[model samples]
Target: SFVASGTFSRVFLVHPETAKTRRWKEKSHDAQRYAAKVMRENDSYIQYTSDARKEGDILKRLEASQIAQGKEVLTMRCFDSFAVVDEVGEPYWCLVLEWLG
Candidate 1:
């Protein structure tokens, strides 16, 4: 379900929302896309518990700060939910984000 190697631990290609997820915009589903950045602790020698939660907190803070400062540098939006990918070796923790392109 996830494609990763070397620098990337996990990467997911997401299409625009269907009936499963609510549509954020009025654009055609096929014309829009999204991305999921899966962060894993297995790559490092020191693994930390609640890896997903920590990362989510950091991202949320970043979004909040950017909004507060009125900065437009960050284009993509980070969602709150973490998508759990049932892979072979370990479960991949992912943050579903708006595709940056």
Candidate 2:
């Protein structure tokens, strides 16, 4: 897992390798990065979830094409999804995205 984090979801800084074997680095604010919009399953607002799903679908299609073309895709180019049990043990799905900066 790459450094995972977001405002709505609990962000974890994950490395591609095992957590113990990987080093953590903070992203520089001045660096160029991609922005990925992720879905927050626990969002009280239903509209947000709907919009996220729509965006995720569109992004997946675009990423598939880019990957096929051998283009340089940013981390944000691909959307990673996960589901976790909240403190109450309720399942929540989160979308991990690259920050466009």
Candidate 3:
């Protein structure tokens, strides 16, 4: 539900939550958004174990270090994730990422 299928990893647009009048006055806020990369299991390259592992390592590195900067004032953050299950109950890994707008 987070992303729509696309040629590359699916891109998602996120909105900032609005705060109550009192809370909004207490802190300064900026707009934030992220894109979740869900590797499509149907893709032929997904069948390669090495490809998955490599991609996972790359993502892990990004998560470990807040080292990647995106456009404008955006930054990439590795958030929570879940496995996509098929009818047969096979689980496919999916990454929940913060997309820099």
Candidate 4:
């Protein structure tokens, strides 16, 4: 389920497959963690959720512009896959993200 707090819907951490499968740097490397920001679909604050989606779009635009200009600006990747989660009998709108360590 997604959470609605302030301007953010929900935030979580996930370990990307690449991070887990890649060989670590032995004693020099710490476990990598990724941060995910999820947009809320059901909430009392409609503007907040709308802003959340807008934020995602902004990030996407930045990434696109950077790529077109041959520059790297965004450090994290975001996706647009509609997520529906069932917690008990209630369904929730959630966004799954990779943890940013």
Candidate 1 CA-lDDT value: 0.62
CA lDDT of each candidate?
0.62, 0.52, 0.55, 0.53
Arrange candidates by TM-score, descending: 1, 4, 2, 3
Better of 2 and 3 by lDDT: 3
lDDT of candidate 3 over 1-101, digit per residue (tens): 35576554565555556665684466445656556566654455454332333465566676555544442423345565566765897656566666654
- On lDDT, the candidate that comes out on top is 1
Q: What are the runs in model 1 whose C-alpha is more than 4 Å off?
A: 1-8, 20-30, 41-43, 46-50, 73-76, 83-89
The sequence of per-residue lDDT tens digits that candidate 2 reaches over residues 1-101 is 24445555454433232234335765444543433333355454444334445445667778887888998764354456655566787766655555543
Q: What are the per-residue Cα lDDT tens digits for candidate 1 across 26-73?
A: 656466665677766334444534455566677778888888999874
TM-score of candidate 2 versus the correct structure, residues matched by position: 0.44
Worst 10 residues of 1 by lDDT: 41-50
Q: Which parts of model 2 have CA positions greater than 4 angstroms off?
A: 1-10, 16-39, 42-55, 69-71, 98-101
lDDT of 4 by residue, 1-101 (tens): 22235453556665445533446545324545655555555454554335445555666777788889999766455555354555665544444444443
Alpha-carbon shift of residue 98 in model 2 (angstroms): 4.1
Report the Cα lDDT for residue 16, model 3: 51
Residue 31 in model 1: lDDT: 64
Model 1 error, position 11 (Å): 0.7
Model 3 CA RMSD to the hidden true structure, in angstroms? 6.9
